[model samples]
Target: MASSWDNRVAFVVRYLYDIDCNGYLDAHDFHCLALRSCVLEGKGECSKARLQKYQHIMLSLWEEIAQLADFDKDGIVTVDEFKQAVMNCCVGRRYEDFPQAMRAFIESNFRLIDLNNDGILALEEYRYDCVQRIVVEDIKIIDEAYYSLLNDDDRRRGGITLTRYQELFAQFLGDQSDDCPAKHLFGPLEL
Candidate 1:
């Protein structure tokens, strides 16, 4: 039985990874996410080689997730399976204890979001990368959420670097506290 916190985390994961909104995560969802990334990068901006790399990374991520979460050995992962995997692998674990697949997924996602490849996520980059993908009722809400991910120092620095994002990602997954700002990493939580 998953706690409400687990459910909330699962909701965030499904919101991001379930690209088709079909309630199950499959290879096609990852493929669509890769296509979205290419589109975000724009046609000629991504180049054929870069597009191939994105596709490969997304597919590999899907493979890793499926291996961990697809308990039925089916091609798709249900929200329940995702929640269970989260409970087993993330909750109560330190960031350093996370599985390689989880770390790879995080790094790959960060790379995909860093459109300029500058190793930092500026506000505009975060806005374009996140807002375009999430279906939010109010755009302002997303802006607020983005700001919440940054501390005063991070704001002063002008952007979040990959290291900051990694720490936040770990918090979002492993922290049991409701006050964690990383809970807003994707967007507002229903809880």
Candidate 2:
């Protein structure tokens, strides 16, 4: 029971990631990840302890913005809202919001990602090469619903500037924007 529950928790975390649980690189998987993580709780495999940590991380990472699908204020993450968030994050030119993040913060984050000393990217790395632009009002608009629920320290590293905030946002956005094959939670469809 515990292991199965852990896998589900991890699955929510995976969905919260830039990629899906199976590591497929696309909005499809990312979105699927969000829904399961958020709205699909309390049904045997869903509960408080099951998703507490995952909620904390997601709020911190996404800057507490409420995705369209995240109708409920719970932090676990929902597939529809997750997909909506991913689409909003990636629908820019070369991830235009990257530059909005703080320079030093972005540089430090880059070092952590470029671990192999190679200019190329690798797996499990969540850094963005593009600069994205996020309107403060727009961010506020999106987060209006779930703002207070994510105010706890469980989801943040204290205070983050607008630029530093944008940097993290862009990295997370780019992480799931790929062309990989999809993985199905309902099991694979028969041909």
Candidate 3:
């Protein structure tokens, strides 16, 4: 059985990957996400190359998920499959290469979120580009989550860089302590 923290992590993964909210993850969902990432969400038009890059990254992520989670050998992954796979492959630390696989996904997502190409995710960018796209949580919660990832200096400077995001990402996945601020990385985990 999975722990509450593992369940929460699985919920977040399902929430993010199930683009259509269809209750299952499939190639079409990943394809839609890739397209959405390339669309002009107030970030201006994405180049053909960039679109292709996003497609490649999302599809690669899909492949990894399928390999790890698609236990039925079917093309789609159900909620149960997702939960079990997340426990085994992620929080369980069963796969040694999982971190490297996740790094690619994280880096790609950071680039997608870092509009303006400034290498830093500004507050507005995080609110508009990242959080708004994922969930309709309150502004205060969103702001708090974003600010929690930053140190005093980084907060004063404006936003989190990719390095900082990577660290927070690690903490969010690996840390099980109640005091971990990264637990709010995708808003409050309903654990």
Find the candidate with the highest TM-score and give its number: 1
Model 3 Cα RMSD, Å?
Answer: 3.7
For model 1, the stretches where C-alpha displacement exceeds 4 angstroms are 1-4, 42-46, 134-140
Writing each residue's lDDT as its tens digit, candidate 1 over 71-159 gives 99989988888878777888878667777756766787787678888988887777777666556677787788789889987888788
> Relative to the true structure, how large is the alpha-carbon lDDT of every model?
0.76, 0.35, 0.71
Q: Residue 27 in model 1: shift from native, Å?
A: 1.8
> Clash totals for all models, in order?
0, 20, 0
Models ranked on lDDT: 1, 3, 2
Candidates ranked, most accurate by TM-score first: 1, 3, 2
In angstroms, the error of model 2 at 112 is 3.1
Query: Which should have the higher lDDT, number 2 or number 3?
Result: 3
- Model 2 segments beyond 4 Å from truth? 1-59, 65-69, 98-110, 116-191
Model 2 score (lDDT): 0.35
Give per-residue lDDT, candidate 2, residue 93: 24
